[model samples]
Target: MSKSESAVLDTRESKELKTPTDLARKGVVEIAEELKHLLADTFVLYIKTKNFHWHMSGPHFRDYHLLLDEHADQIFEITDEIAERARKIGETTLHSIADIAHFQRLKDNSEAFVAPKDMLSELHSDNMQLVKFMRETHEITSKHNDVATTSLLENWIDQAERRAWFLFETLRAH
Candidate 1:
């Protein structure tokens, strides 16, 4: 396809609310909105996880850094799925970095220094919060009868829970 034609088609797709993949319109609308928030949360957490991975220090620096990196990768991996699911249902996915910042419920950490324990603790809390969002998304998807999304969210929750568990155990006092 020509570049202009592709651009035009993209514009049309963005405006469309109907597709062969249609679900109940109302249900899809509601599900898509919640998914956007979930996507925002996921994006924020992914960045924070990477931040912690980069800034981590102290006794268990290597282990903590690697853990955060792995967690960040897992978190980043799901963002596409969340966004694509929205598009599949005839909704526009998150459009830009600002959109993620605007919709995200998670807080960012920009301090120059954070102790290893503090980093672990903060990431743990944020991840737990994400799982809460995932569970809520699960309900929204289920209510909307979007089994594909519901299934994906369940997997997300599991990954989040595992990350949270690792952080929790790592924080435990010896």
Candidate 2:
């Protein structure tokens, strides 16, 4: 190669790669883009959970805060894996908080004094909504035979469902 061509190549992080799996490149790209949207929603949910965790108060402060903290950590764990999945499929992943905000379907709560029950109810609803999104994304992964992602999503779905379940029981009337 010529000197000019060599310098141009050096500027790149990595060369374009040929995906080794039988999965179609076009389909992988499509799936990864959708995953980006999922990642955004996940981020929003994580932040909301953490917000509730930090602001928790009243009689059940200890239990509620700990629950939210655990669930928030679980939600945060999914973000990096989803972003890496996008990269592994040769697609660009989300870059900034603005990018996540743009794609996130969940609402952010910045109020100073939401009731504990209200917080639980909101997070319960959001976790269930996430289960819906995860199921939809699973369809794409299943269609493309992305076994690794599909398997990981199964675990995530269960975690989200469990969070919703716990919150639902917590919010029940006597």
In candidate 2, the residue pairs with backbone N, CA or C atoms under 3 Å apart (3 or more residues apart, or in different chains) clash, namely none
**Which stretches of candidate 1 lie above 4 Å from their native place?**
1-18
TM-score result, candidate 2: 0.87
Q: What local distance difference test score does each model get?
A: 0.88, 0.88
For candidate 2, the C-alpha RMSD (Å) to the true structure equals 4.1
**Clashes per candidate, residues 3 or more apart or on different chains:** 0, 0
lDDT of 2: 0.88
Q: What is the lDDT of residue 38 in candidate 1?
A: 92
Residue ranges of candidate 2 with Cα displaced over 4 Å: 1-21
Using TM-score as the measure, the top candidate is: 1
Estimated TM-score per prediction? 0.89, 0.87
- In candidate 1, how many Å is residue 135 off? 0.8
